[model samples]
Target: MTAPRFLQIHWLASYPGTLINRDDSGLAKRLPFGDAVRTRISSQCLKRHWRTVEDDWALNQIGPEMAVRSREVPEYRVLPALEAEGVATDEIRKAVVLALAQALYGDKAEDVSKRQALLLGEPEIRYLISKVSEIAAAAADAKSAGEAVKTAFKEEKANLSSMRKNGVLEAGLESALFGRMVTSDRAANTDAAIHVAHALTVHAEQGESDYFTVVDDLARDAGESGAGGIFDTELTAGLFYGYVVVDLALLKSNLGGDGALAGKVCEHLVHLIATVSPGAKKGGTAPYAFAEALVVEAGSRQPRTLANAFRQPTAARSEAAAAALAAHLSSVDEAYGAHEKRHHLSLQPIEVPNSSRIGLDGLGKFASAMASA
Candidate 1:
C-alpha cells in the first residue's frame, strides 16, 4: 500500500552549555510554553541550517545550488551581460529601471520598491537577460528598446504559471521544498511543503552568564595585573524538542510531480533533521549533536504535536523526556486509537506505542520507501 499523505517527525536533541539560537538582544531565544519558559530555536534558523549545509545530506546536493535572492540582479547580472553585447548604457538602465522593473518587481516607478531582495531562479534570470538583449538589439533607439522590454515582460508574466508547472523554473530545490512567496503575483508563489515548529526545551531553560577575560600575554609577562579584554556570553544546556510535518502530496506537486525526487528528499531530510544541529558558537561550545530520541509517524489523520506531553515540564535528561513522551503516546493511542504507522529510535530504547524500533539508516530508508509507495 502507498504511504499516507503526511509524515510527522519528532525529535529530542541536547546541546549542553551552548546557545543554539539567540534573540536580537543576544540572549538565548525563549518560549513560555506550559508553565515554564523554554529555550527556543526558530523555524527559520533550523531551515537555514538544513538548506545551506554542505555535508552528505545537503539539500542543494540533490539539485541546483540555490536561487539568487538579490536586489542587484540588474546592476550585476543584466547590465554586465548587456554591456558585453555592446548594448548602449542608457538603453540598458532604462530597460532595467523603467521596463524590467515593472515586469519583475512592480508597476511602481519609484526605485525603493525595486530595491527589495527578490528571489529569482537561474533559468528565469537567463531568460530575462536574453530577452532584454534581444529587445535592445531590435529597437531603432533607446526609447523603443525600453518599450519592447516592457512588452516582452508582460508576456513573460502571463506565462509564469505554465512555466512553473512545466518545470521551466522550479526556483531551485530550496523553493520547491520550503516554498517561496511572491507578494505581487500569486501565480509565482509556491506553497511550503514542509512545515516546521519552533523547537524548545521541555524543561525550564538552564541558562548561565559566562564571563571570561582575554589577557594580553605581553602585559602578563610584564607583571601587569589587569586583563586586556573582558566579555560575557549567555550559555544554556537542555534537551530540546523539535517537530516537523511533511506534506507528501504537496512535496511531489511542488517538485512538478517528481515522486522519486520527493522520496529522496524525504530520506535525506530525515537524516538532516536528526543529525544536523544549529551551528552557533561551534568553536567554543562544539554544540554538534544527534537527536537523542526520534519518533516518525505517517498518516492522513490531522497531524498533532505531543508538546502537551511535557505540560508539567519534565526533567532535561533524555531518559526522562523519552519516558514522558512514551507515556503520552500510549495514552493518546488508547484515547483515539492507533491509526498511523510509527517508527521510534531512542538512546535509551524506551517504549513508543504503535512504533517499530529502528536504527537511523533503516528509519530513513523506511520513511523514503513509504513516501515513494
Candidate 2:
C-alpha cells in the first residue's frame, strides 16, 4: 500500500471569561489529563464550528455544489426542482417519495412520508432529480410515475453503480472531507478524510464561578426591585491546544482526484481553523479569539501530535507552552530524522529555533505552502 499522505494542524489559543461547553449538571466541560484537571471542548463541538465555516464557504464560493443535511430532501430540494421543471403538483409529490426511496433505500425502501436526515450533496441531488424527471416524463399519471420510478431502479442499477464508481455522488467539498453514512445503502458511505482531536487547555486550571445579577432597565424605570435575576456561571481561562489531521490522498480521492479542489479545501480548512472560534457562551462572555500560534505539517509519513508537550502545563501568561511544544518537535525530528515539512505562523513574536517562522500577514502564503505540499 502507498504511504499515507497527511496534513496535521496544531494551534494554541488563549481565551478569557466563561465559555461553557456544559455537561449534564450545566458546568463547563473538564477532563483529567496529565494528573490535572483541564478544561475541554469536545471534538463534536469543534467539528460543528468547522462544518459551519465549510457551509458558509460553500454558499459563497460554490453555492450550486453545496450539500445540505436534512430529512426534508423531498419537500425542500426534489419537489422544488421538479416543480421548476413544470411537472404537475401530483406528479411531483409522487416522484418525490418514489425517487427518495429509490435513491436512499434502494429496493428495500418502503413508501414513507419521511426519511432519515443525511448529507445530500449537489451532484447526488441533481442525479436524483434527473432520474425522477425521466420517470415522470414516461408516465401518464402520478400512480404511473410512481410505478415507473420503481421499475427504473433495476433498469438503472448499472448507471447508479457507475456514478458511485466515478465518485459523482460524493462531489460536495463538505461531504468529501467530513464524509457521509447511509445506513440503508452501505455503498454510499464515504470514509472521513479529516480527524480532529478534542481541544484541551495547555495548562491545568479549574473553572471559576462568577456570580452576577441582571438588572432590568424597564423595572428600574417602574420603581421595581434593584435586580431582576441573579445567577452563577463557571468559566475558565488558559491557553488551549487543538490538533487536526487530514489525509491528503484520501481527500483527493474523496474529491474524485481533483487536485485543484483538494488544494482549495486545504487552504480553506487552515484559514477556518486559524480564524474561527468554537461555540461557547458568546452572548454573555463573548470569548471570541483566534489561534495564537499555528503549526502545519504535511507529508507522506505517519502523523504525530505535539500534545505531549503539554503534559506539564505551562505558566498561564507565559510563552513557555509554545516554546516547549516547538522544542519537543525539534527534539523528535533530531532523534528520528525529519519525515515531513513543517511551517509555523504566529500572531505574536516568538522564536521556534528549527522552524521557518512566518507572521500573521503570511497566513494565506502558509496555507498555500501546505496545499502545495
Candidate achieving the largest lDDT? 1
TM-score of each: 0.89, 0.81
Candidate lDDT scores, in order, read: 0.81, 0.72
lDDT tens readout by residue for model 1, 139-239: 77777777777766666555345457657234767777788876645687887899999998989989999999998999999998998999999999989
Query: What is candidate 2's lDDT per residue for 1-373, written digit by digit as tens?
Result: 2333888888898888757477788887887888678998888788777776644443226332667787666567787777777765675466556656656655444544445667777777787788787767666777767766766665655433346775743445566787777764566777888888988888897578889999999999999887889998888886889999988888778777766666677777777787788857888888778788988877777888898888887776537888888888878888887777667888666776456787554654555555544
TM-score of 1: 0.89
For model 2, give the 10-residue run with minimal summed lDDT.
55-64
Candidate 2 residues lying further than 4 Å off, grouped into runs, are 1-4, 23-26, 54-64, 83-86, 90-95, 98-116, 133-162, 165-170, 212-218, 226-232, 361-363
